[model samples]
Target chain A: MHFMTALKAAWRQRDSLLCVGLDPDPAKLPAHLAGQPEAIFEFCREIVDATADLACCFKPQIAYFAAQRAEDQLEALIEHIHRRHPEVPVILDAKRGDIGSTAEQYAIEAFERYGADAITVSPYMGRDSVEPYFAYPDKGVILLCRTSNAGGSDLQFLDVGGPAGQERLFERVARLVAEEWNTGGNCGLVVGATFPDEIARVRQLTGDLPLLVPGIGAQGGDIEATVKAGCSADGSGLMISSSRAILYASRGEDFAEAARRVATATRDAINVHRPT
Target chain B: MHFMTALKAAWRQRDSLLCVGLDPDPAKLPAHLAGQPEAIFEFCREIVDATADLACCFKPQIAYFAAQRAEDQLEALIEHIHRRHPEVPVILDAKRGDIGSTAEQYAIEAFERYGADAITVSPYMGRDSVEPYFAYPDKGVILLCRTSNAGGSDLQFLDVGGPAGQERLFERVARLVAEEWNTGGNCGLVVGATFPDEIARVRQLTGDLPLLVPGIGAQGGDIEATVKAGCSADGSGLMISSSRAILYASRGEDFAEAARRVATATRDAINVHRPT
Candidate 1:
């Protein structure tokens, strides 16, 4: 199925807009799973099994895995999750961006190497650096806009010359991407839940384009305001993601259950504010 | 040696500011060495050996090697080149940028995995994304400012608010990075050769910060003008780079020799215009 359709189905079945991020830090993993790749895999599998009913999708931050030299194992783990929960979408939060030709190779890696339903990208290098990812008919490309971190406003909120003489860079990017790059409705924007006003503004600019709202959990972003600001007019296009908060919900044997509890709370909170 | 000192030494020894980029395309490699990773290694070794005396530094665009699933071979190639000619620095042209924690992992990859003397980075993610790279005192971080590409102006030249009210985003980044991020002198700016005015402006803003100027040879940038615009006041701190035009000088048996010839010519051209 296409990414959008699959996303829609996930939302309907789970009744949630939450995308649980599986950023398994070895140091934060349960003591039994600390160093063993198999333990890590089993831990993630259990978490997936426990929270599959609550999350619309799963976003595995690739850096945490790549940093551990567990890239191959992470790929296998993601494949396992996809195979087990065929209805749930998997977004690879890689944030990769490079020159035109290089981006194509990354596209192959994100889409072919791991079979990701969606991938996050950095928009620092402009359109050519991003267009290659769109070549995949089934994958969604989530471009970083207003990130949740404190320093994010330093660059994303810059002013740029536009049809109206001046406009915020992220707003301009949102408009241009929505109009020019959304050829297949597979393009999305990442607007951190921390910036509700900007989120509302970007939502207006992007029309029906899906917004991946990160920063809700560990980043101190408000879930209710984010859901109200990010959900599309028809109530579907927001992938509210939480990583550290859910992944390390408990540092003990009950970690997977703790994860399910957090995912359930986040999912229920979003459902309360999800546009009708 | 400090990055600036090494750059100055390279400039003085070769009497040239040329830094040839060693971006080997598998399809464009000599037919005699086709389809073999060993052949790719051999080709890179020959080119480095032949041109070591002429070029100031060798920049291996990581993407070209990564595209072929030959990144390990490329790492071996870099180690081989560095061992053969220890004076010539290897700048890994990977424009990597991520959050602070992730950037630390990338720093380990670039400095430890490949032992790159310098690495290029995109500044779109702001200060925290780049600070971790500076933790290693010996290595250098070259921030991407105005690029040589046609579409680079699309965002790099946007107006970001600064102490000067409104300035080109690249110029603002140059000033901010030089003042705030260059405390250890390990930070540099990537100002493309294609834009002489921007290069000059950035050079002035950056002061003594080393500039890695790409887009010289096959990209059609003017070498003499770029050197004049990019060089520090002391006639140093510039690593003018060219990739495709140097590495793929010929697609035949004498490809390495042809690469050396073109590199020598580029070096000679830069020598003619160096400030006394």
Candidate 2:
């Protein structure tokens, strides 16, 4: 099935807009898992088991695993998650961007090697850096725009001189990407939940394109405002992601259950604000 | 030693400003080494061996290796180059930009795992993302500004309405980074060779911050103009990089020798335009 269709199906079945961000920071892992690569795998496995029903999707930030040189363990953990719960789509949060040729290799790694239903990309290198990823009909490419950090406004919100006299850089990027780059419906934009006004403006410019709304949890973004700003015309297409708030819900042995409770609260909050 | 001091020492020893970019595309490798990962390692090893004496530094673009899932090979290649030719500096060309916490992990990976003398970073995430890399006093952190690609101007040159009214985004980034982020002179900016006017402007803002200027070869950037635009007041803070134009100089067995000739020519061209 296509990535969009699969995402929609998962959202409907789980009745959740929450995407549990699996950013397994080894330093912050439960004491039982300290210094054990296998423990990392076990921690992820337990989290997935507990919150599989509460999450619409699972986003594994590749950097956490890549940093540890735990490629084999990461692969094992991902395989375990997919094998056991085939219904939940995995969005690999690897903000990779490169030239056309190199981009192809990353596409292969994300889709073929890691089996990610969607991957995040940095748009700094321009459209060619992203076009290669669209060759995969079943994978979605989410471009970074208006990140959830305080410093994001430094460049992203700059008043770039455009035909409209003055416009925010992210608005122009959103327009260009929506009109020019969305040859297929596989394109999405990552608008941080922290900026609801920008998110609303970007949603208007993007039309039907999906929005991956990260920063709902540990980033301290207001959940109600994010849902109102990012929900599509049909009241879908927002993947509200929460990493540390959910993954490190507790540093004790009961971390998995704490994670589930947090995921459940996030899901309930989204449903409360979600359009009927 | 401080990064600037090391850069100056390399420049004095080689009497050259050349920083060879090792971006070996798997598809572009010689026919004999097609479909083999070891070929990339061999190809990079040969280039490093051939040009170690002629060049001051070697910049291996992380994307090229990362696109191939060849990080291990890249680590080994960098270690080999350093072991065999300790005089030359190895700059890892990875434009990594993430949150402060994530950036710490990346710093550890780039400096500790790969042992890079300097690593390139994307300043899009703000000062927090970049400051973590500077925690290591000896390692250099090169920030992206005024990139060489055609679409770079789409955002980098945007009129960001800041305290400096109508300032270009990259110019603002350069000024803020130089003033605030460079506490140890370990900070640098990547001012592309393609834009001489922008380079000269950024050069003034950067003051003594070392600049890694890519787009010299294969990208059609003028060598003399780049040197004139980027040379520091002291004639000691620029590292001009070229990749395919040198490494893929020949497709035959004599490829290494061909690379050497190109490196010599590139080095000579930079020397001719060096600020007296």
Candidate 3:
């Protein structure tokens, strides 16, 4: 199935909009898993197993694994997720951007090597950097629109020429992604949950296209506001991501159980404001 | 040594501004070393040995290694570059951008794990994304400004707020990067060899800060115009990068020798425009 189609089905089947981020930090690993062989993969696999039922998707940030020379383990973890939870789609959050064949290589890395259902890309390099990824018809491409960081305002808020105050760089990105880049209907935008107003604006600009709304957990995004500002006409479409809070819920042995409890609460909280 | 200091030294010592890009594609690899165990590393090592003296720095685009599941080869290649040819700095052409710990992880991946002297980054995420890398006082961060791709004009040339023609998105990025992001002076920008006018504009905005100019050979960039527009006041601050033309110069055993011939000619061509 196409990533978007699979994502929508997963949202319905899982009854959640939460995207559990698997950014395994060795420094924060549980005592039992610390210093063990393939701890990065083990910790993440357990977290995936625990929260797979509560999540619409899983986002594995590639930098975490690549930093430790654990690309092999990353491959294993993604395979494990696919085998254990066939319904959940995985978003490999590498935020990659390049031109021509380089972008093709990265697409191959995400879809072929790691087997991610969808991947996030930085659109700063323009259309060519993104078009190469669209070659994968079944995969989804999420462009960073308004990121969940304070420094995002540095350039994303610059008034790139458009109607009065309506065409900041982020909004321009949203419009472009909706109008031009989504030709295959497999493209999406990343509107951070911290900026609910921007999220609402992005949703207004791009109809029911899926928005990967990252923030919420340790990033302090208001879940209720995020749900109301986001969500499609059908009261779905946003993959609300939470990482540190759920992953390291307890530094002790029952970390996976604690993760499930947190994921359950977060998924329930989002549903309260979801209106469906 | 600081990356800028090392690059300036490399420019003077090597008497060249060329940055040979190692974008090794399996389909493009030579017949003699096509399916060998470490073909990527072996090919890149040969190219580095052949062209190391003629070039100031070497750029290995990570996607090439990661796509073929040859990241270990990539690690080995960078190590070999440092060990064999200690004079030439290595630029990890990953173009990575993220925020907070995620950004830090990428920094570790480039500077610590892979051991690159410098790395390219996308400035779309603003300060926070680039700041993590700056934490390493020795390494360098080169932000994407005006890219070489034709699609770069898609968003880069949009009229972002500023003095009339001086505020296109790319120009705005140049101004912001020059004004604020270089606080520690460990920063630079990537202005493509394709657009010499924008390269001149970026040079004007960012005084003597180095520019990593890609797109000279296979991308059809004009080398004379690139050198004329991109040179620092001292006429030796740009790292003009060429990939396919130099890497796959020949598809036979003479590939390494042909690569050196191209490197020598390209380097001499750039030096003809150098002031001193």
Candidate 4:
């Protein structure tokens, strides 16, 4: 299935715009699962079971798994999600970019090895670096546009002269990806929810292209403002992701129940402002 | 030891500017090592042993290893290099960038887990994304500037209006890294040898800062022109890397010896235009 089709089906079935980030940091794992060999997988599994129905997608940041040398566990988590909750898409937040052959290798790693439904990619190397990920038409390629970080303005906000006249670097990227690079129709932009005004502007630039808005909840992004600015006319095409906020709602044994509570609240919060 | 110090030491001891890229494709492995679990490591081990004396550094592209789920092998290779060829620094060409916390994980994965002396990073998300890698003052963070691929011009060549008047996007990145971002003196720029003009321009822009020049050999980069345009006045500050040409010089049982021959020729070719 095409990424957009899968995404829409997920959004419809779950009645959600929420994308829960499954970043299982070893230091933050629950006390019970602390010393276990499969801590990462087990933590993610419980979270998936608890919030699978409330989330439109589950984003597993690859860095956390890679840091602990638990890539095998990451693969298992993705497989578990696929087997148990097939409706929810898995976005592997890898943010990887490279030239040609290397980029192809990364695509294989994300799509084939890890079995992620979608993966984030960096666009710093321009089109060729990002094109390889687009080869999987069934998967989504979420390119980093305006990040939520404080230093995001350092290079992203530069005024670059382009075919579309003088626009901020991020705006130019939005225009390019929306106009020229969306040939595959599997492209998406990662515009942080922390910057709602930028999100609105990017929405204007990209039209109907899906936006994966991070920085909500843990990053303190205004949920109503993000939903208002990021949503499409049909009240879809937006993925409001929250990682730390839901994952560690309560570090105790009720972590799964707490995560479900936050996930449901986040999904409802996004829907309240989403266009009807 | 600081990355520059280690790099200079390696350059001096090896008396070469060539950075042999250890990207072992499983399909390309020798017949004897075809189905072996340690094929990737053994292939790289032989290649490293053959070309270690002729090259200044070894850059193992992480994607290739990650594709095969051989990160353990990658770690073993880095350890092997450190044990046997202690002088040659290993630059893990990851091109990784993300938000602060995730970037920290990537930093640990590169510097702590893999023990790479340097790692390549993407500067798309700006300062904070690349800052984590800089925390290790001893390791190097080589940022992508002008890439070698065909679509490199897509966004990188945009005419961005910056503090220094109207400069291309890559130039702005060059200026940013050279002028303000290199406070730790552990930063380098990746300027592809395919674009000698950009290399020269970047050389002029970033004085004294080292350049990691790829696109040599199989990428059809002119070695002499690259050396002439990329090298600093004292003829150092440049790491000319070639991967495919050296690794696949001969696919037969003499692959190791063929690799060494090509590596030596590449080093010699790079030295012809070096400032004496």
Candidate 5:
């Protein structure tokens, strides 16, 4: 059940590149679900059931659950997803970065306690910080590179000097991730869909590795540009994630059905740009 | 109270710069506490009470609690510290990094949910990612710069391009934190004690802002060099943190008292090298 194997199977069966990001903001929950007991879990479970067949994966942003003091619900949500939709993998979008043993604890939190198939991690602490996550063998580690946010340019665009020549910070990260850090071939890069040019560059550096592109939907990323620039040689290896737009599409009693509609449209739209 | 104000007052009253790192490893608990239900909380609360007067602040690495499904304990532990040792601020060593509303959720998780006075964050995502944390005006944000881990050099030491001149990635982060990013004068930088030279380098860049030094004790960081290089002109702008060598000092029933002895000695050792 290595992440890539599970994800590729999912992408083929569902015919999707969409990763449903489960960022259940308590303040933004639907009128029916808001203020309800276990609201985060209840809302997310409905979304998962509605979109399970359409999505390549589910990404639970841990911060949202933690902020609401509903970590127990996060645990329950992941369990429900696993039991109900064993086809789709879960990537815990924790973005955790620490060294040595601490990293191992986070790995356990994401993969063991939460049962996520993969986890997003910050690479600021470098190799050791990331390697501990690899201990799970099947779990995937997605590193942040060329984020969609404007402030991402503040450092990621900086060109690194050395024998490495003029490779920009993100480019160097891509190269390093593709070569050195991809120890078990379970590594991926998070290249924002908003920056399709950078996404293409990262694709060139990382070869066939999956790129989890987060943007699109509410972030205004062009789906066609993202698909054309990010897809692998086989026209896959991309997870174009959309959160707010899909999650809160209607915010009514039919929210889950509306989410399924949005997820369906998003998947078909991405497939239209997929190379034949 | 603002983080720096509370920290400075603690340092002056306690006469120490030690940030007792509460990384309670469930697997490595003492003989008597190994299988206890609330062992993590009991161990940490005891350690806190023992080292409260001897240390300037307490830093609970969130992963340790999250891995053991003890986040409730982490919340309870922070509440206990706030009530008991109100003088000492708690830093949630999360190394969290995300963007916009997601970042705001993380801030709420740290400042509001866990009631931590400060939280460590990764600056790889740049401004907006770090800015949400600043929304808590009184709280502090410490960015990762020159982390202690060996792999830290993989990207942090690279020379940035463009108008930033030959400044290394960490130096640029330091400059940004000091100049543009410290919107409300409540930002700090994390420079590992393992690299005193980089610490001095970061100290030179960030001015009088606090630098959290986390590689001393078990990590083999030289206390004198760390204190000398990291201290401000006023001799009180650093929190030299140590974890394993202090926490697992004895591993017996008196583990709490042993932690106190190590924290006390480490604090006094740091004072010996202070400029004042």
Candidate 6:
């Protein structure tokens, strides 16, 4: 199945738009899992088991794994998620960009080596850097549109001249992704949930294309406002991601159950604001 | 020593501005080395040894190594470079960006795990994402500005209002980087050798900051024009990078010798245009 089809199926199956970011920090893992070589993998495995039923997808930030030289563990974790929760999609939050040939190798790393259903990319390098990812029609190429960080405004908000007069860099990116880049129909945007207004603006620009919205929980974005601004007309296209808030809900032995409770509440809260 | 001082010292010692990219593609490796699990390492190791004395630095694009699950080789290559050619810097071509905490992890991956003297980064996510790399005062953090690829024009060329007047996105990036982001003095820019005009513009914006210029050789960049446009007043600030044209100069057993020949020619070509 294509990435969009699989994503929609997962969304329907879980009845949730929550994507738990499995960005494990060794400093924050349960004390028992601390100092263990397999701590990152063990903590992520438990988190997936606890919240897989409540999430539409799981986003494993590659930095956390790569930091500890745990790419082997990352590959294993993705395979485990696929085996355990076949319906849930996995998105690797690795904002990679390079020249054409190098981009192909990166695509292989994200899709072939790790088996991620979706991968994030940066549009700074232009079309050739991103086209390689489109070869996998079944995989999602999520581009950074409007990020949640304060520095995002540094470049993304610049007003550039376009065919339709002046448009912000992020708006231009959303338009280009929707019109020029989504030929395979697997392209999506990473618009931060923290920017509810920009979320609405990106939605207006891209229509019903999937938006992997990050920056919700620990980043202090309002879930109600995010759902109100980011949802498609049919009410089902946004995937609001939360990491630290859910991952480190409690630093104790009950971390898994605590994660479950927070995941469930987040899902329920999003659904309440979601259109009927 | 800081990254700039080391780079200048290496440039002066080598009497060249050439930076050979160690992007090893398995399919393109010598037939004898193919199918060998250590092909990536052997190809890169041979290429480095052959060209080390002729070049100023060695850049290993991480994607090729990661695709073949040869990060161990990547580490080995960096160690080999540091041991064999201590004066020549190794810039890991990883255009990584993320949130703050994750950026720190990426810093660890590039500096700690791979032991690269410098690493490339994407400025898309703003200041925070690029700041972590600056933590290492001795390490170089090269940012992508005007890339050589066609897609680079997609976003990098868009004109936006700046302090003085309308400025292209890449120009704005160059200015911001030179003005604000180089507090640690370990900053550099990746301006494609393909775009000489933009390289000149970036040089004007960032006076003496080192420029890592790719898109030469196999990418069809003009060396004379690149040096004429990108070099500092002293003719030593630009590192002209070429990968395939030098690494795969021959497909047979003489690949190493062929690479050395190409490296010498490229360095001599750049020197002819360098100012005395």
**Cα-based TM-score, every candidate:** 0.92, 0.94, 0.99, 0.99, 0.98, 0.99
Residue A268 shift from truth in candidate 6, angstroms? 1.1
Residue-wise C-alpha lDDT for candidate 5, range A89-123, written one tens digit per residue? 99999998898889999998999999999999888
After superposition, candidate 4 runs with Cα above 4 Å error: none
Runs with alpha carbons beyond 4 Å of true place in candidate 1? A37-43, A161-166, B37-42, B161-166
Docking class of 5: high
* Candidate 4 all-Cα RMSD: 1.0
Model 3's interface RMSD: 0.7
Interface RMSD of 4: 0.9
Superposition error at B4 for model 3 (Å): 1.3
Deviation in Å, model 1, residue B180 alpha carbon: 2.3
Better of 2 and 5 by DockQ: 5
lDDT of 4 by residue, B1-276 (tens): 787998998778777889999899887887888899998999999999999998889999999999999999999999999999998999999999999999999999999999999999988999888988888989999999999877888889988776657799899899999999999999999999999999999999999889999998777889888998988987888999999999988888899999999998889988888999
Q: What is the CAPRI rating of model 3's predicted complex?
A: high
Q: What is the TM-score of chain B alone in each candidate?
A: 0.96, 0.96, 0.98, 0.98, 0.98, 0.98
Residue-level lDDT tens digits of model 2 in B1-276: 565677778888888889999988877777777776588898899989999888878999876776677888898999997799877888888778877777787887888888898888887767777888888899889988878877677668777777866798889889988988887778888887889999999989877678888888888899999988888887767889989899889888888999999999999999888888
Residue B254 Cα positional deviation in candidate 1, in Å, after optimal superposition: 2.6
lDDT by residue (B79-183, candidate 5, tens digit) is 999999999999999999998879999999999999999999999999999989888999999999899988898899988853646788999899989999997
Candidate 6 A-chain TM? 0.99
DockQ of each: 0.48, 0.47, 0.86, 0.85, 0.88, 0.90
Q: lDDT of each model, Cα atoms only? A: 0.81, 0.84, 0.92, 0.90, 0.91, 0.92
List clash counts for every candidate, in order.
0, 0, 0, 0, 0, 2
> lDDT tens string, model 6, B119-200?
9999998988899898888999999999999889999999998887889999999998999998888899999988999999
- State the weakest 10-residue window (summed lDDT) of model 6 chain B: B1-10
- Give the root-mean-square deviation of each candidate in angstroms: 2.4, 2.2, 1.0, 1.0, 1.1, 1.0
User: How many clashing residue pairs are found in candidate 1?
Assistant: 0
DockQ computed for model 1 against the true two-chain complex using alpha carbons = 0.48
Ranking by lDDT: 6, 3, 5, 4, 2, 1
